[model samples]
Target: MDHIFFFYFAAVIAGTSVLVVALRNPVYSALALLIMFFHVAGLYVTLHAEFLAAVQIVVYAGAILVLYLFVVMLLSIRSEERYHNQLPVAGLLGVTLCTEVLLLLIQSRTAPAVPRGSAEAAAETGNTEMIGEALYSTYLFPFEVASLILLVAMIGAIILAKKDIIETTE
Candidate 1:
């Protein structure tokens, strides 16, 4: 059943997400995050959002995770034995968030479901097309801003790397 698949994906995603944060080793944490990403893509597939599923796999799991691993390897970061003192604060926030989520879930279950659009309308428009339209239309300015920010970041990274290379050669 759809519910079974949803629950399975949700459970894996939740577990892996926790593992991603709790793991001491950066590589292991990234790997856990990779598993979480795959499960998220699976969740999207279960929701009939094939394009989103593919994008999630390709963008987050493939590109972003690869970038994270590269940074981890290049930096050669060592795991610190001492833990941060923020555990109590984090625990309090976590408990508060869990309670809020539970309340929201309960409220949603009791609320009447409102149909935003008919299945025929969605089917005719297609998920990809709808997303593309919204991205290029309603969210055009924000999208462009994000792209600009990425461009600046890329250029800055290149400059910094070049300086390091020059210094090492000297």
Candidate 2:
């Protein structure tokens, strides 16, 4: 059943997300985050948002996780070990944030489900096509701005990464 699949995917996402935060080793935490991303993509599929699922896998799981791994590898392990003492403070902050989010969720009541379009109509047109039409038409400027922001961030990361390499060689 759909409910069963949803629950399974949700469980994987929740477990992996917790592991991502709980793991001490940066590499292990990144791997756990990768698992969480894939499970989130699975949830997108369950929602019939296949394009979003693909983007989630390609962007987050593929590109972003690779970036995280590269950064983790580039950092000095001895320096990282020095930060072990900060874990307790980080854990306390994380717990506080989690409690706040849970309280917010509990206070918020779900709205009634409203269907935008019929399943048959959506199936006939396809979800991706509809999304593309709206994204390019109604949301074109915002989309372009987001892409530009991401491009800038990527370039900044590359510049920072190379600066470290250049410094070490000098």
Candidate 3:
């Protein structure tokens, strides 16, 4: 039952991810990416990480996808008629990476599972609480840094939009 849901989500995620790269139109590509993000949130739900699933949907599918669509619309980009001639190189690299991943998967399946320690104990503490503790305690500096970066980006975007508005009015 779980396997079925997992496979379905995985298949959609894989297909949409490919579409995200293969679609010629920027809007279509971003829409495909939005689908992929929803499927990823579904995957997180299946893993019992409900908080992560919510965050994935709200932060990625909600905010990030909206941001991407706004950028695509604002830029008014047109699709190019000719494709870049890097297909052969991309194909070769893809094949190499796929082979390496397959080998790693096979090796991991045969290896003995290591016993969990603090992580297992943390599981009893609830996902959201544990994440909160780590975010506030162990990872506070990195979390604050990420927030500061986002703040700067938001300010820069506002400034750019304001400049464009002023230019168009003048």
Candidate 4:
């Protein structure tokens, strides 16, 4: 039963990922990418990383995909009539991506899997306390800087999205 479920999920993930790059229409590609992200969250769930899976759905599927959809709708890009023989470029990019994925798979196959602490054990040990200790003791500056950068990016995006006004007065 678990084997079949895993196989089905892997198939869906692979299919949707390929469709995301193969579809000529931008909107269809975006939608396929949304599906691909959902499958990725499902894969995370299978690994027992519930928090990461929730973040994947909320950040990638909810926020990023919505941003892509907004841009697609705002541009009204329904067809490939504006593209200039980009199929070859797309094929090259696809080949490069496949090669990278192949390399990653080869590397992972040789690596031993690390056992994770059970969620119950982690909770009993104090999950929030452990996370806070790690972040503050080791990764404090990097985490703070990253948050600052994200804030700047959010402000920049809002500014760019605002409409421009032109005045003609004689």
Candidate 1 vs candidate 3, lDDT winner: 1
Predicted candidate 3 versus true structure: per-residue lDDT over 63-117, tens digit per residue: 9899989988999999766667998998999999999999999999989999866
Consecutive 10-residue window with the lowest summed lDDT within model 1: 161-170
| Of 2 and 4, the candidate ranking higher by lDDT | 2
lDDT of each: 0.92, 0.87, 0.91, 0.82
62-159: candidate 2 lDDT, tens digit per residue: 99899889878877443244546877899899899999999878766675556677688778898899999999999999999999999999888787
Q: Give me the candidate number with maximum lDDT.
A: 1
Best by TM-score: 1
Candidate 4 weakest lDDT stretch, 10 residues = 161-170
Clashing pairs in 3: none
TM-score, cand. 1 vs. native: 0.85
Q: Per-residue lDDT tens digits of candidate 4, residues 10-104?
A: 99998998888667898999999888888888887776566677888999999999999999998987676554687689889989999999999
TM-score for all models, in order of appearance: 0.85, 0.76, 0.83, 0.71
For candidate 2, report its TM-score: 0.76
Give me the displacement of residue 52 in model 2, in angstroms.
1.0
For model 1, the stretches where C-alpha displacement exceeds 4 angstroms are: 164-170
For residues 1-170, what per-residue lDDT tens digits would candidate 1 score against the true structure? Answer: 99999999999989999998888899999999999999999999888798999999999999999999999999998876766899999999999999999999999998998867667877888899999999999999999999999999998888787757767787
Best-to-worst ranking by lDDT: 1, 3, 2, 4
Task: For candidate 1, give the lDDT of residue 64.
Answer: 96
Local error of candidate 3 at residue 111 (angstroms):
1.5
